[model samples]
Target: MASQNILDVVVVGYGPVGQTLSILLGQRGYQVAVYDRWPSLYPLPRAVFHDHEIRRVFHAMGIGQDVESISQPSATYQWFNADWKTLVEIDWSSESISDGPVGYLFNQPSLEALLDRKAKSLPCVAVHQGWEAIELHERADHCELKLERVTMQDGKVTRSGETQTVKAKYVIGADGANSFVRKSCGMAFEDLGFQEDWLVIDLKPHEGVKLDVPDIGQWCNPERPTTMVPGGPGYRRWEFMRLPHETREDMQRPEKVWELLSPWVDPEQATLVRYALYTFRSLIADNWRKGRVLIAGDAAHQMPPFMGQGMCSGLRDAWNLAWRFDLVLRDVAPPALLDGYTPERRPQVRAVIDASIAMGQVVCTSDPLKAAERDAAYLAGDVPPLPPFPGLTDGLIVRTQNSADGGIAGQLSVHGQVQNHGRTMRYDEAVPTGFQVIGLDVDPQACLSDAALAALDQLGAYTIGVTHDASKVVANRVLYDVSGKYQQFFAQHDAKIVIVRPDYYVFGAARSAAEANDLVGMLIAEIGLDQASAASKSHASAVA
Candidate 1:
């Protein structure tokens, strides 16, 4: 056992979510300590899908190039009936607000490995593998974690006979579904009444082997509900719903795997990388935060993999919480700001889970008559449209019900290419982090009153005026909208100015200059910017 100074955050579980949070914090120059049970990276592929939103997080993490290198864009995803008729289709390759494909297929192992390397590369991050959090104690201002090292022999766990204690200002549980921190915080899960066993198999084709497999489709056959999809480069995956009479052992047999995958490709032709039975269920934590402790990722929610949002949701949680932590840790905002995380994320996650469950119900039917009815309805264009990506509805977002009243609150802002001083880059790269007051060919600073301008400045918001004309990029603050997406976005909202939060969600918008000042005023009052500033000054004075 050894002693160390109190860190900014002690993250339990160095999975994707934990690693992401650690890297984000470390990048902000905060000290982070990560604990995980495994001695090294987990080589198996579990989640093989990521949406554009998660890709945005990768961009924030400075790993967009690595992600793009190892990921493949998904094409149309189709649902088929027992007879292989297309019941419904979703354009997975559709453009996202982040200016990329809506969905991507990737090997989870490679993604995690890249994240691990990135997190460890940061001087502020301490990645302690082979260490597990055994206990957690929550204090008024900090959290204490008891960690231990365990030795394994022949895949069996044994005590390494070593233990240590670490103290941090906050603790995050990204420790998968069976999160110790979630349990330690005494949170309960509300089951969403969806649970089923499915067998997942990952296959990698030998170099230069041309193996035939069905397009990414959900076979809604009552005989055996199954999913067939490409698993990024050099890989393929299939999921089979277990029948009533089948047991876990029965499904895990090599013969059963071959039997299930036989329809797509002969198992003998491709290499069997891994196969395992998983119980797909829908559950969300009753509470995501308690005292100084919080949970994210699989520890907070679990949804069926039909929508491929399981991992994406967790990553979103990490992204959302990381920004909030940055503000709170810097004393720019009160701890109450963290209160918005659950209210904002829970609804989004619930919507995703509900959609996944509904999709699973449509694809997991064991009745032929129902499947036929579904097929007929879809063919008749009577089926429900695929739900749009969920947005922040009630948390920290400003909104107005009246269409005549301007407000794009709670919605995510669009990212597009921008040219600043002859350098072309994404809007996110050009604009500084924190709050951003963006205008369409107009300077938002001209709209704010002196008090409002002071408030905005205190919140660390900067104004960026974007113009569609390339000649308008004469100043450092005025960017050229290279793709015209920003212009179109403002026109669609009928807004002259928009207030974007650091996490890229639209806080509010204004249709006029006066209204922009009013919006800034409202934000200052709503978020208690003045009070925070006063309190911060008082604290600094007291410390001096």
Candidate 2:
């Protein structure tokens, strides 16, 4: 019943997604209030893999090294038949645009602890534990949230009769699968109907002892499909599919777990960290935003763990929303810019969900005959390779009139090392993350008109010239492409100038300075900066 000060954002969960969103907003000096029902961090591991793109996000948050310290780079993910014959092998060790291995494995609990510490350390972020959001009301200009303090004892939660009211310009439900905020907002999940129950077991081998196991692999045995992968630096995880005759309760028993692990290791060699039954399902929210209240992470989408992308997708959502929130909160863009969120992210998430389901179908084939057919198809090269992950197709990205020739509008921008002032560092570390007008061999500032340049400055955009010619390198302006990635990227795209969004997605690219100026103009108009700037000046005059 007590009133509280209005904040910029009220995040209704303290999980990794919530923590990430809060930290991003707090770093930008926004007042963020984060609430969680639990009193402390979850002690068990859940998600164990993140891609290089998410690693770049960690770097943007200034924790790239800390995250790398707790993670192990995944080399390859293999699928094997019942006879241990390799059916497929995905090379996760390949370098990506983020300039690291394609994927990594980490302990979720450790990551949460790191992110929680970072979020709380920011003066702009207020973290409240043991507070459950009871109600959310979206007003014309803001939203009101009601919270109640609760205590957990013996695996039961009890309300303490303490209540508080807080207001925020926006309310984000980064809550988990059963999100109360999602339910309150009347959003429904469109289930893709792919579901399977599996027992997930985490094990920690005794120090100095080694267990014989594939680093990361899926055993598509008709009897029981199994997954063996690293849980982190010093942990291992095994997942066994539940057969038709098995019950969830039976699969979670410690003896049953050890029986399943008998092929790999025994109790004497390793300690069981935790075991639980998880029903992997593919689901996406019908809507991500309902007025001033929005949902993200597991609240917006869920997919089978076949691709190990469930957590990665959620983190991407946080990163995508954080930059948009910053622009909207600062009044640099109209509120309608928020409308681009669902359209841009939904299709990409759906693509991943579909891919994961397709993979699950291949791995979860329990019938011996079907499994044999699947293996034969894979061995015979009859199955097509999985398609590359999709990019934004329906959002704020600029598309050519002929949609097929959209260029690299939605593809990820490359990040490579560059030399500036006798120092070599990653491009992002040298240039802060934002809208970047990067010229491959020309100066972006020289390419744009006065009006366009001023607009870029107003939007806090960075203009940099990158060239392979070392003589062209200038302090804080022109950078030498030490790794040649910039040249290669531009050459591949046939672009001399690229306009990258704050989230590292290319807005558009051009082959000439004139085209580049037009591209910048398109960006300014698309984001409605001109309208926002005029409104701000009008308001200032009225106040005077």
Candidate 3:
């Protein structure tokens, strides 16, 4: 009887990742219930940075206006040695293909609050705070989750707990590092061989006052490795590595914290908002999915803070999984489509972890001799190159001659300033959901075959043609690329048409109408749409 009311999806955890997933599911008209132990959002600073790709996700969720209000563009991230000499610098201020600042710094609490408000406005989304998912039972058609209602006395002190059960077609674990869902699934982690404890402090000065500190930089001094970064609008953050002899309790003391901040500001002048010790670890889950149960965010992987991608990566996972789940639940495609999620996302997460660990190695040095050597190498103009942004290497991406190498396939689709009808906005804002067929000064509809067109229509894909001149309108949803980025991208890839997935990844591309049809056919087959169509045909024949 309980199984009769099974939801479309059950999400365990109400953090940013889980909340984002809930809203996405709600937007798709899926019944989603989110469970978390805490009664409210964590009102402290956690993640402080996100890149353009994440900003794109925010826009998809209809909260772009809110994000612009609370976020500030991040500057170059510089690294310096003992003598304050510059080593390697990553230019985060450059424009990303997503049509915004490469990176932005913002308060995590504010972002989460905005997400919570948006989630509440949706009818299909229900957040059950003070409830925790404690146990799991997998059935043939649905997953069962046992949830506990937690009662707290003094804001956080747990007083009592009551348990209940809910069934869902699928279960997603977006909980933090210490996830009960991951443990319930008996999943293990593959340690990437990196761990360190560091004391993190957040401070805010009196109104109309500003603390004097570098915007963002790493101090690679052998005596003490430290990091200073802008913590949103009126806040600042500093992280100090805990030496071998230091304990977590000692480093968290107010006096010890003051000693670390003495160089920048007087402890008496500024208010210490939050201070805590964190152990940064590098790990990736051995398996992201087991049967109908899947894990995302920290439950799937964890990385050091060097790249500021810890939370951003989790958000990406949510975005990637949301569309796949939506497609399966709607029966638009077969359940096998979900198989691509782990393969497509794990490699991307691994790339982020590896890059973060490499950056950590550069800043976690404790030897005087090695520090001197590093500084000397930098002084001699021998700085190492920063790693390029990671892209998808496998699963649901094209790797053929019709949509040849160096094409847009498997990469994130680029955004440009576009004018649609009389309105001007980013390209993505014009086409927010589903697969899109974009053509450069060409009509994609005319290029696709009847079968391909039928499949795309079934998927609810948007067909738009981008042209440089507004006078030459050749398609219904033609947008004028005012910034010229779109034209540049098409020319560089030698493609007239490109297929973009719902999550804004390039599915494939082609230089001509026939090739465009082939590209669309390839995506249809790869995503199991062809199988669904075949099954429908066989069922009709059997009925006859």
Candidate 4:
């Protein structure tokens, strides 16, 4: 065997995405190095969206369970008039998305700290906080990252100098909207720049207003439209609409900011913390994986915050790649196995962007005629619930062996209760551990010949072959199912080998053992693993 690479992954930037990636890689025993321009996690809170999947990622990192107590549950989603009259209401508590908690009410700082701590806890992860990736170049086999050293003073730059280069086999860019890595990779950000500017202010109400309202509440009118969200830990967020020709001075008038909130809460009780102007756009990269480097999160796609999936989409990308990297890094899968990451993610990435734009059009409607029409239509007493977000394709994608059903059909069934006393194994329940799931509608012994069973016992994959109701099979892999209904995969993507990546996204499926063997062989080939190891009796004996 030739010498293997010393480092497996080099992650750029130390934001949530970067930190999460580092910790995941480290946990998998990969030598991971991280570079970031900033040394400290700012108490600054910038984003607002956190869906159920994001919470699951946090839980996977051992950090999510605390989000709800700090951030109140948004129970009733609504649109209100500037005069404070309700226009439209949707039940946010509908438990619409999944059994997993959806729509976080917390801010960025808290979440980042949680992730930052997790990254530092990993034994194989090294974080270089104050270093920035100043330059980058990829050779035929290796990619090089040049980190520049810098010194800063009271809110200003003091000194900038020498660059240190680090080489890695795989690189991930979670930098930011203005990602240097993305820019250097020659990936273009197609910003559909918004026609209006939005002024967002973070405030801590002196006397907090405790109300169960929305995942987000939109105050819509032609003149001014604002959004209010619960920013956990006594923090409240406000996004005020900015019209053309309006100056920051006009928006800063304490009276103007208060008018938007005074309807729901007292003016004297709230104090503004931070305020900034924003223009929304939905953008996607033409290509996600370019050469040796790949991009995720804001670095790859930028969606308006209207739909609250901005961060969730990115975290899902990290989830999908992290486990696959484990396979490739450990030489378990073929290197080209990484090829599927981009194609699998790009469709959903683009879908979220489109979802945001479509939803934004409805939530932020400003046309006088249209606004009146919306109000009149609501008064007419016939408005369907918020149009289902097509961005959620988790349930729709079915990959199973049951070809007619579009899901993998299982042949594993035993007429009599045949017990494998020697095996002494059953699916572990209670604690949630994410794994690649193989659901058996019946008994496993009936599904395979000795050879196939022997092969599975060899790979040692974290695959739970559960023999029970199809519903019970999906219950353990609950984190990945957006709707907590994984059994639907039977009808969505027809196949028996339902390959689910860590992030809950299906990689692809195989309907038969031959297909599974082919997919497994392809994976093994990529990681430089013994090709026959995935399907051979010899591989099985080694594990045994």
Candidate lDDT scores, in order, read 0.84, 0.89, 0.84, 0.62
* Colliding pairs, model 3: none
User: Among all windows of ten consecutive residues in candidate 3, which has the lowest summed lDDT?
Assistant: 535-544
How would you order the candidates by lDDT, starting with the best? 2, 3, 1, 4
What's every prediction's RMSD, in angstroms? 3.8, 3.5, 4.0, 6.5
Looking at model 4, residue 268 earns an lDDT score of: 61
Q: List runs of model 1 lying over 4 Å from the truth.
A: 2-4, 152-156, 401-407, 531-544
**lDDT accuracy of residue 471 in candidate 4:** 45
lDDT of 4 by residue, 1-544 (tens): 1124546889987887888888888877888999877767755777756765566566666665665545555566677765557877766555522343345567788778777878888889989877778778898777888787766454454446766788898889999888988999999777655445787878776754564444468877777777887777678787877776688677767777666566666556667787767767777887778877999888988887877777777887787788768766666555665776776667667766776776577667777889788777766777765544332233223333332233222111111111122232211223234334343342222344444444444444444333324243333232122232333544344545554434544434556544554554443343345534544654221111
Instruction: Give per-model TM-scores.
Output: 0.94, 0.96, 0.95, 0.79
lDDT of 2: 0.89
lDDT of 2 by residue, 1-544 (tens): 7666788999999999999999999999999999999998878899999998999999999999999999999979999999999999999999888787899999999999999999999999999999999988988888999999998776588999899999999999999999999999999899999989999999999999898889999999999999999999999999999999998889988889999999999998988999989999899998899999989999999999999999999999999999899889998888888899998889899999999999999999999999999999999999999988677787778777212255688888888998888889888888888888999877788777667777776676888889999878777778899989999998988888998888998888888877977888889898889833442331110000
Candidate 2: which stretches are off by over 4 Å?
401-406, 531-544
lDDT of 3 by residue, 188-232 (tens): 999999999999998887777666676899998879999999888
Cα displacement (angstroms), candidate 2, residue 419, comes to 0.9
What TM-score does candidate 4 get on C-alpha atoms?
A: 0.79
Model 3 root-mean-square deviation: 4.0
Model 4 clash count equals 31
| Candidates, ranked, TM-score | 2, 3, 1, 4
Against the true structure, candidate 4 has what lDDT? Answer: 0.62
Looking at model 1, report the run of 10 residues with the lowest lDDT sum. 535-544
Candidate 4 ranges beyond 4 A from true positions? 1-6, 66-71, 81-88, 96-98, 151-158, 193-195, 207-215, 252-267, 377-435, 440-446, 449-460, 463-499, 506-531, 537-544
